[model samples]
Target: MTQTAPSYVLGSSEQEIARLDGQAASIEAATRLLLRAAGIGPGMRVLDLGTGLGHVAGLVAELVGPGGQVVGLDTSARLLDVARERARDRPQVTFVEGDVRSWRDAEPFDVVVGRLILFHLHDAGAALRHQRTALRPGGLMLVLDFDLGSSRADPPVPLVTQALGWVDAAFRSAGANPTIGTRLAPLLAGAGLVDVQTFGVQGYLAPDDPRGPALLGGVVRAVAPQIMALGLATAEQIGIETLAERIDAATRATGSVVLPPALAGAWGRRAL
Candidate 1:
């Protein structure tokens, strides 16, 4: 059984980068809280995988302070440029171009972070095992990903529900795991990390807030090309242009806040 692995559905494009930056605004605080709780602090050498627009990497830089070093690695050199520009003020933060599964450093990291990157991987457990090798003994490893199955519009907006399903289907078709969050503890343990533990961070975007709908719509928009190419959806069906407006309208009508998938954090430490 040669099952083809999933590809990166959300591509690296100017538009996609902008949308990601917009989405990052809403989730930064939550991510910071998770990183802090994960015990990332000053003097730690941290490796941030799939750094994207460098949101999480910036946060880690702040947490680690001037005493620590943060290296953000991504396959897209374009993204690495964005990350570098954004991190210019932070001397301790650096951006490197590489793949998470194969990139290595002679100097081991005190912590390894894989945020929103697990689902994109074909063999996430194997990837974790490889990453674990880069961690120093007793190094902390953090895996944060979205449990998108939990995302929905309160009062059950049909359109909202349908929209969620569309994203899930597209992701699944791409071979990504939209709901891998809740099942991370065992994955970490299986990767040979000890003291495996898990946590969840939830963010509620008020009914009137545009961020929630924007976040949801942005994802669909980013993956629309791939979605259409895969025959999982069509552009007209996705309504690429006004998707956010419609989602916001529906959520506002219900007076129910929008919940964008729970941020599940699973972490463990390498053997001491």
Candidate 2:
């Protein structure tokens, strides 16, 4: 039997974009690292998995210029639609709607990239294994995800911890590893990638960073209701509105909040 396409709630999309926009600098840094790690240049072919909003793919397209190609694959039509809309005039870029786990291409890619996608999978290790044959010899595989294990700082508010616990549970239910970033290097190595490496990047939603408040504020607004709807906490126990208010107040007071430390990258090259 044919499988149906996965659907994402509208709120999820907005939250994702907000997260990206809020963390734009970090994302950009990660992307540059991936490009440098992969040694991408004009005339190379790159495949980007989970191309949410397509900003990363668009950047790759520019890097590759007219001689190279960038294809972004995503399961969310809504996200892909947004990506395509943004990439309309760029002939070097294309977006495809499909499952990254099962999608096939006629030719192997020089680079395969998935930013913040592996943690969302039920069997991320298996998913990484599947990409082995999709890459050419010496090809690069790059991933960017949150390293939950890196979260060492204490939550400033007790309620914040409760809300975070709920969000973690919700992500776990969806088969995502909220802390997958820490295991990325090992995962890549196990997948037979050579020269595996990992790195960290941070974003603060505290008073000092201007971008932090707007970004963290957006995240709070986007995720508050979902956290409440998950049934993990009572409205009174961890009030969604209250969390928003606190995040807002914190942002205004500090400028941005410091997110728990996160791993920004894992990368390696396919063995020849």
Candidate 3:
């Protein structure tokens, strides 16, 4: 008998595009670090797990160049639509709608990569084990995720700190890990991967950073429903309509900066 696979809790909606747009810069920065850490280069076949908007896949496609191929897989058709649009000019990259846990193919790839996708899984280790089968011996697997609990702001912004707690609670309530970043190496090792390594990246929002508030606000608004359902906040407190402006105002008023969650990247090679 076949076992059922878990689904992605946060869906692919217009909201996903908004989130991706808001975090584009930071994502690009992390992408560079992840690709370099995994030693991705030209002519290498890559599998992008939980491809989402496919922005990362586009980056990998460029690095893999014309001779290589990129297969981006995600569970959300909505996201795959956006991904396709994002990659319309790049024939080397292809997006498919599929669950990472159940996805398999006869051909193996040189590299498998994902960002901010692991923590959302019910069983990330199990998914890694499955994805590993799609990798050739000694192929690389790189994942970038977050440790929300380690998030901090200098000079202490009470509201920002409190907001993170709500975010963590909501994620946990939805059966996701808010702090899965720091655990990836052990997860990889347990999955039978070799030479596991982990790295950390901090996302800082300067007091005068133009996009700082918008990014944080977009995230707050996007997750407001989950926050409310988890009883972490009430509708009035969530204030979806005004939350973004209010957060922007509050940070400016206090002369404080916002620090997004600390991100962590982990990589390991498929055992030979």
Candidate with the greatest lDDT versus the true structure: 1
Write down the RMSD of all candidates, one decimal each: 1.8, 3.7, 2.1
Model 3: per-residue Cα lDDT over 164-236, one tens digit each: 6777777787777989988988998988889988888777777666565676566667677888887778988
Instruction: State model 1's lDDT.
Output: 0.86
Tens digits of per-residue lDDT, candidate 2, 1-272, equal 12233323223366676676555555576567656665677887899988878877887887788998899998878878888988999999999987887888999998888887787676677778888778999998988788654442133544445445665665665446778888888999998899988876764445444453344344445545555677665557654445556645654553334565464688899999
What lDDT does the true structure give each of the candidates? 0.86, 0.70, 0.80
What's model 1's TM-score?
0.94
Q: Summarize candidate 1's per-residue lDDT along 21-47 as a digit string, tens digits.
A: 876777777788789888999899999
| Model 1 regions lying over 4 Å from their true place | 1-6, 230-233
TM-score of each: 0.94, 0.82, 0.93
Clashing pairs in 3: none
Residue 71 miss distance in model 1 (angstroms): 0.8
Write down the TM-score for model 3.
0.93
Worst 10 residues of 2 by lDDT: 1-10
Which ranges in model 3 have alpha carbons more than 4 Å from their true place?
Answer: 1-7
